[model samples]
Target: MKKLRLAVAVIAAAALCPFMAKAQIDLGAKAGLSIPNLTSGSSSNPINSGWSSRLGLDAGIHAEFHLTKRFSIQPEIRYSSQGGKKDGNQGFAPTPEMAGAFQQMGQPVPPYLYATYKSEAKFNYLMVPVLAKYHFGFSPKWDLYVAAGPFVSFLLNGKNETSGTSQIFADDAHKQPLPFPAVDFTRDQDIKNDLKKANFGISGHVGLAYHLNGRSAIFIEGGGNYGFVKIQKDAKNGENNTGAGVVVLGYSYRIKNK
Candidate 1:
């Protein structure tokens, strides 16, 4: 986490290198949504879930160091809430490719995979991203720009819950809680212990800004962030790598030169 913060700081400083003569330091805030899903390791269900409509809220403050007429460095620290859930039958149907694999394995056709485990997890984080933006001012008061960079997230808190039957584990089977498709796991299993603690990812940002009189501006940004960490830890000490996506929209104040 310290390394991530240091990297952002370094990038922010570098953004200022070219502008040391006449510097413009600006700050702003933003908010948005995060949509995420779980990927299954089962060859029968290789891809976990896709595009489930879950929304997350994001807000951040950024400082941009203008170094030249067209270049600047922006460093940000933000708070984000992101997660996803797979419901038994709420669009959680397995894909044809998955179904075909199950058929090949000679597994019984499920009435749906309410027989499968549907898990939902929530995550909160403090993220820092250093981005390089190109500013093209249409007039002396307004400008357009684009920025993209890498980001790191520190996992603050998370919860994992599941409702369904899964036989992935060979320990024991208790079907009283859910009777759909008898999952072969015992009640002694602790699902929460199987989740990841940190995440590393990338973000792409594009937005327009309007200079409000002095050094403040209101901006709206829409972009997607893709995380490369598996939200889950291995139940069998194997490997698990799942990721998350975020779409953001919000307003901010640019506190530097217009």
Candidate 2:
């Protein structure tokens, strides 16, 4: 499955090179802010687990090409970080039975079952956006254009981490033998692993841009990306969709060849 996904991504990128030559190529840099929203699983222990969307930063260089007078394609290489944190009173709180087992086994019981975690997942990739821009060249000083398209992004970094208490064992009995239902034991383990990294996903964008002369435009875009891959691998017991909103504000400059 991993091989298939990688192959598809390679093909998608190869298909965009020709389109680049067909459009008006503009080379420029753009910087923007990203708001990250994290969705994860639940815990039986009440250690105050919650995720927040942080304001992330993004910077990249791109080429904008006008395939047609009214249509353009933008392929960009960007480096950006997007992920949230679970902090405050968040950690692992072992049940009474579980704590007793750890004590009996002479294992070091964690002070808190849950601890704060930060996701520093970063990506460096080439993104291709074929935008259908409706240019309203009303006057020389002012022109408005509306654009929307399907954009593709690849994963360059898969860094991830998870921290929590070992609450499954009661006094080292975890090494012994669990006589109860196997599903219960599996559920506990699943939650701990679910707080890992997110898989790659797809996004769609729509926005309006106001052109400043024939070269530059500032735009604000709002949309959502539906993550086709599971963000949390072990959280099969809970919802682990990587769906996130795309909130960006920046400027694009059209490179004119002299």
Candidate 3:
């Protein structure tokens, strides 16, 4: 009976050792910069012009669950700012057919006229991401990690602003400006209703962490998020996808095992 009890105790202690060594939980806050842009679908209207990346912000809190010595899962809730800029020249000249029609009417075809338009779109979102992470120990106080995950975001607000200058020339040869005053205008509008309320996407990250102590650490990371869903709802032609690259700095605290 004594021998059997000794064997049982040994086996139980062996089973519990791995769990006690590997299981840990952490919570943290993070904030950073993001470069956001839109990817337009093939069927999208060319008149809308192309998009360029815009600078934005991201901030959030995250909870990490360590399942083993080298593997973990982190879930975060973050507020993100995203959007893009569009700048181009539109309605520059009359088409060949239009010019012919003017000649037939005996109306003198006025010199070519053109307008330059510059516009920006901004969006705010509440985003949730669940990431599976793999860690590698680089030293006693430093660690390197990579993570991949999926995320969903809800749009909180959106705005669009546009400004333009229209120029008229005295002749088609492009020399001499018309005496008429140049037209300049600016407009701003809320566009929440024009955009989809929710977006779904995949995200990936790579980062390095420095442990301040057994219970605390600081980390820096760079990653990107890509959306599969269209950003707009009432699109006449194609889809607009959202994508962003992010850089962040964060602090974390490990909860003591009771």
- Tell me model 3's lDDT, rounded to 2 decimals: 0.78
Candidate with top lDDT is: 3
Best by TM-score: 3
lDDT of 3 by residue, 143-167 (tens): 9999999899999999878788756
Candidate 1 residue 148 Cα shift, in angstroms, is 0.5
Q: Return the TM-score for each candidate structure.
A: 0.65, 0.55, 0.75
Q: What would the per-residue lDDT of candidate 1 be over residues 1-258, giving only the tens digit for each residue? A: 989988987996677576653757776667766655444454333224332445566778787778777887778897866666554432224437556756787875442333345656566777777787888777877778888887888777766455665533211232323222444322233444555767777876777787776666777676666667766564332234334455555455544453
lDDT tens per residue, model 2, 1-258: 989978986897688668665556666665666565555444542332355665556656666777666666665555555555443334334557756766887876554443233322222333444444566656665555555555555554443334433223222224433222222211212232334333445555566566775777776666545444544444322244443455566677776532
| Runs off by more than 4 Å, candidate 1 | 1-22, 38-53, 89-118, 163-193, 235-258
Predictions: Cα RMSD each: 8.6, 9.0, 11.9
* Cα-based lDDT for every prediction: 0.60, 0.51, 0.78
**Number of backbone-clashing residue pairs for each candidate, in the order shown:** 4, 13, 0
